[model samples]
Target: MGAIYTLGNAAANRLSLLLLTLISAEVLDVDSFGVFSLFLMSVASIASISAFGGAATINSVVSKFYMRSKDLASSVLTMSMLMSVFVSLFLSALFSPAIYDIANASGAYEFVFIYFLLFILSLLMAVFSSLEGAVYALKMAKGLLAFSLLGLLLSVASSYFLGAIYGVYGAIASIFIHRLYIALSAGRLAIGKTGLHVSVGSVKRNKEFALMAFRRLSFPIAAASVLAAPAVTLALYILGKREGVASVAEFSIVYQCFVVAIFPAGAIGQYLIAKSKGVLSEAVNVRVQAAKYLFVYGVVAFLGFWVAAIIASHYFHGKYEISISSFLLMGGAASIYCINCSYSSFWSSLGYAWPIFYSQIFMAGSILLCSLTLGETSLEIGFLLGSVSQIGVNIVLLRLTVHEKVAL
Candidate 1:
């Protein structure tokens, strides 16, 4: 039942995102949509980083201590929330000049005033998002699904109307409302279940544990955020600068849709990590089963993405042009990335996260190289090359590390 709820929540969340993207693309002008996409990508990247790798680190720590000590779990949550807020504010202030530059150039200076507010809202959203790690770690799948569904409905409805009437600002405002709801819902659940005491006092008490947690998990947490958020945003920003906002718009649409294709793999990976917390043989069997399913799903999903791309092009009334070849390549790349996610979850589960961190560095370097050489045309190509490189390295590491650990 937990597995069922987990997958269902993932599906609902992905579908909601898909709908939001579709609606935004449909309602906003191409240039406006491009800016909106840029805003979302940038905020997401920064928020992920600010979350202090909460998705991985918080989840792992919460899971470890959830059963043994509720006080410790609450302490972890308290410390994470404090750090999330601090990082968000610091980053927001740091990026203020750039935000000003963009607003001034775009003649949207009035809206620029809202940037700081948006940053706070986005940060709160991210902190709440990090709390989901506790939910998943605790196997509160039903509660997760319920909150995700409610958030999705709120996001879709508000985004649709606000986007149609208010444009980008309205769209962002709507997103803020959605995030606020999730944060409240997830917050209530976490506090209710674990009795979280998120005071400065709690943080002071847990400072030692927080330091230990950061020392242990900082590398992978930072690496994962760098790869997932900022790296992708940087790629898209470069593409937008060199090729045009239209190119950014096209690729953003493709990437978002393609992500849905690989979400099942992500879901399975999380499940495996959560469930395979026992005997060595059992963990190996879990990985084997996960691999088989991912292989089959990836093949089918790659084909399905091609078909979906065609339909999407028409559905949007040919607003943005997407090459079938590029679309398929990106889809294929997304599959490999999903496979890497599985290995990452596996490594994190076993306290061997540094290998995943190292692989991301290698992957980032490869993508940066491609961007430098291939220029604007390499966005989709980078996706493919980077994924292949990361997956290859992770597989070798997984084999060597798992065997060594098992032998020991």
Candidate 2:
């Protein structure tokens, strides 16, 4: 799941960065950029809450019931479906105001205010996530990868072409369709042969499981601040408030490369959940497989991204520019986080929810303070530093959970 998602994510992020960079320069004026920037920030932030952040727990529990209980898939599916609908409604409400404000600030068309409805994309994602959980439950990582890649392609092609044709509004249209495609395709599959279903009683019963799952995931989710929120905050800090939006947009594009890196490893972690419990029993095969994949992720990431960055810098021109140091450091930091994320899954498998859940302190600070502290003169440094705390927290948590010999 991680590898495939990473590839798809990389392609999409690169495309988005390229497209947005151009739009930031040629399409959006400074005020427009500010408005667009706010929308960008809200998309990530609201989606997290909107989804109710339940996918991982869904992943863990669904995996357990599917592989072990077999009879529980329908119940898990049912719970997922219900949660998806609830999350969408909740997130749509949360994001609507932000969209309105951003659009009002942009002073574009009145329809720009309607951009807040994009939260529907997030809500719809909750639905897709439920379906994804069903896929995860079935250990259908490859199928999930295909489903994700399809949506990614749709998003990439549509957004790029649409943005070029209709500016940000066109981009918005692409987003609407993207959500629809993902929800329909993945949702149908899970509900089809698998009979993935959800219910209210199951939601009540699984609340504890869900909470623990959230507790375990807080580190990773918070760690992600380095990519979007902190990056935006740091840009605003360093670049003078005037340049904040543009700088945020720029580094966001660059940092997305790191986010893309997580996909493949993430896919692997998702696949491993079914047998994750087997690790504690000194399952040599599982441990060995984990070790082998970790090494593979590292080697591929190191080699692949370095080359891509070089090409992006030398050939892409204007838009993809990054200083040599920033590029390398960013990639290295991303690589570190990737490995940590993989181990965090192992910790999760151990029933410990890895990174020892210490990231709570770091996540908040990283966003508000660490990012805010970066002066425009130090934007790159800020991007590199913010994720460090997340990486550190995960490392410690993984150590606490995994057997040393496990090579996590």
Candidate 2 lDDT, tens digit per residue, 1-408? 444543453344335434444444344444454445555555555455444434555666666666455345455555545555565555455545544643454455553445445556656655665566566556555554566566666666776677667766675667667767766876666666764555556546666654555565533443343234434533343443545344654555455565566555655565565556435653334545765676677667766667766766765466434566656666665665555555555655654543424553454455445445544325445444545676677656546545484454
For every candidate in turn, the CA RMSD to the true structure comes to 2.7, 4.9
Strongest candidate by TM-score? 1
Candidate 1 — which residues are off by over 4 angstroms? 94-114, 278-282, 375-377, 404-408
Model 1 scores what on Cα lDDT?
A: 0.72
Per-residue lDDT tens digits of candidate 1, residues 1-408? 876887787777777767787788888988778777777667766787788766566677777777787677677777777777787777666545443443334545544555676477768767876677677777876887898898788889998999999998887777778778877777777667565556677557777887777666655666666665667766766676677777777777887877677776777666666677634665666766776667777787788788877887688666788777777878888777776666666666665578777787766766566766785447778778878988888778776776655421
Model 2 clash tally? 19
Report model 1's TM-score to 2 decimal places: 0.91
User: Each model's TM-score, in the order given?
Assistant: 0.91, 0.75
Question: How much is 111 displaced in model 2, in angstroms?
Answer: 9.6
